[model samples]
Target: MRAVTYDSFAPDNARLRCGEVADPKVGPGQVLIQVRAAAVNPVDWKVMAGGLDGMMDTVFPVIPGWDVAGVVTATGPDTPEFAPGDEVMAYARKDVVQAGTFAEYVAVAAPAVARKPATLDWAQAAGLPLAGLTALRSLDRLAVGPDDVLLVHGAAGGVGSLAVQLGRDRGARVIGTASEGNHAFVRGLGGEPVSYGEGLVQRLRALAPDGVSAVADFVGGQLETTQAVLAEGGRHVSVADPRVEQHGGHWIWVRPDGAELAVLAAAAERGALTVEVARTFPLERTGEAFDASRTGHTRGKLVVTP
Candidate 1:
């Protein structure tokens, strides 16, 4: 099988190479997917740069990717939930950093695989799992609902964009922070857009004078702004910063759950959620995709097709 591999943690993504590797073997409770598309995430490049060295163990010549949209070629014994020819997607992160989704094929534990939303094309589907899951988890933790003003940092970003829509779906009045260029894009996602950076707290206060009822910080380094704008008895969560925990907010890490993913898929099928894909690259050009992701300015996801 042809796939991307990095022999060591290269901060510049210089070690990424595309070549033949042994096909993955299906084990019990696993399903083999023939890759169609995979999404590039900041975590992919961060992992490549050894950013997560003290956390997950890396087996080098590591394959780099987690979000995948593909078709099942086979299922291992005891995996009665799916069979050959099923279209599926998953956040296919392993306990160790190897055998990932940036390949011609990948084998995932059945419990982490969900049926692909038929309404989405391959690129969009590939972009959904991780970002959607992160957004979902953040909102669930904050318990956003009607009568609350939800403030989303990085509103036009991959996860933040989805969080805006999901918050709106739950009847919250969402206020999103983005650059001046992305304010309209955030508005399209059903959020009232506010520019981040200087005077952010004042701007948020102008929108919600009592301060916001909840804050979801998708972009880190905004703890001060979050604390300043949160109303009394409000809640906050951050996927990027752990210090949020010390401030009485939750620091969330997304988990792989097919059942939860299925709920997102159903929402897409119902037209309540959508994925924005910024660009698509071929399998061999994954390094370029990582470069785009590292820029930290793209409004949506970058996808790679095999």
Candidate 2:
């Protein structure tokens, strides 16, 4: 199978290369997916650069993706949930960081696979799994409700964009932080946009004078601002910063859960959620996709179609 691989940790995705690799073997409770599209996330590049070296063990010549949208080519024994030809999407992060979604085929645990939303094309579906699941978990942890004013940092980015829509769906008034250029984009996602940096605290205060009821920090380094603007009894969570945990906030790490992903798929089908794809790259150009994600300025996801 053809896939993108990195032999060793290198800065700027220096080691990423397209090459042939052995096909994955299906094991019990697993499903083999013929890759249609895979999403490049910041973590992909981070892992490639050895940023997560102390966390997840990595095997050399590693395939580098986690979010996938594809068709099931086969399913392992005991995996009764799906069969060949089933269209699915998954946050296919294995405990080991070797076999991954950036390939012609990938074998994933059945529990991580969810039927793709018909409304989303392959690129969009691929973009949704990791970012959507993260947003869903953050909102659920914060218990965002109709009366809450939800402040989302990095609102136009992958996870933040989804968080805005999900927060609005729950009837919260969502205020998001983004650059001036992305303010309109953030607004289109149902969030009131506030410029980040400089006067962020004042801007958020102007929007919710009493303080925001919840904060979802998709971007790190905003702990001071988050603490300054959060209302008493409010909750906050950060995917980028674990220090949030020390400040009475939760530091969230997304997990693979097909059932939870199915809920997001249903929301997409119902017109209540959408996944934005900034651009699509061919499989061999996955290195370029990683470059785009590393810029930290894309409005949504960067997808690679295999």
Candidate 3:
């Protein structure tokens, strides 16, 4: 099957190579997915750039991707939650560096796989695994309630966009930060929009002088600025930067849980959730996808349909 694999830690080494690699053998508690769409994420670029090189090793010929949306082609032994033909979406585990969603097939643990929502297509579903779960996990940490006021940074990006919708569904008043171009989109997601620029903190303070009840920084560098504007005792968390604790705030890491995905998928089915696909590229254009995601200020999640 065709997959995106890199030989070195250098971003220049990135390429889409065609080769006849043997299909993955599913082990106990795993499911083989014939990937229809795989979402490109900041994490993908981080891996490609060797941010996790110490962990993943500067391993040559590594297929890198996590978010996947596809149909089950085979089920591993003792897997009883799903059948071979079930449509599923998931985030692959960090431990599996070689086996990823960049290919036409990926063998994902059953615990990370969940039925795709009936309301979403393959591309939309593909965009949910990482960013979507991160947003949900942060909200879960804050215990977001209908009456709460929450702030999300990079509101136009994948996680921020989902956080806006999820915050609204949970009955919170959401304030989202983005550039001028995404104001409408942010407001449409039920967030009060704040423009992101050099004076971001000032803009937020002007709009929310009393501060918000919770603060979630999806964009790492913006943590200090956002946390500065948080209301006293507000829940502060981040998916990218673990240093939030140094600021006397909190942090959250998105965990892969089938039960969590089940709840999130059901919410999507009930029209309480949405996944935004900013752009999509053909499998052969994986290089372009990585470039855009790494260099551009993306409006939403990028996807690759192999």
Off by over 4 Å in 3: 13-16, 56-59
**TM-score of each candidate structure, all chains considered together:** 0.99, 0.99, 0.95
**Candidate models: Cα lDDT each:** 0.95, 0.94, 0.84
Worst 10 residues of 3 by lDDT: 11-20
**Cα miss at 148, model 2 (Å)?**
0.5
Write candidate 2's Cα lDDT for 142-220 as tens digits. Answer: 9999999999999999999999999999999999999999988988888999999898889889889999999999989
- Residue 43, candidate 3: Cα error in Å is 1.0
- Which candidate model has the greater TM-score, 1 or 3? 1
Q: What is the full ranking by lDDT, best candidate first?
A: 1, 2, 3
Lowest lDDT sum, 10 consecutive residues, model 2, at 10-19
lDDT of 3 by residue, 1-306 (tens): 888777666655345564556677899989999999999987787777777767654456777788999999999999998888999999885574667788889998899989999999999999988888898999988888987889998889989999999999998999998888999999888899998778888888888889888888888777778677888878888877788888866687777877788788998999988888888998878878888888658988899998
lDDT of 1 at 179: 97
Instruction: For candidate 3, give the lDDT of residue 250.
Output: 68
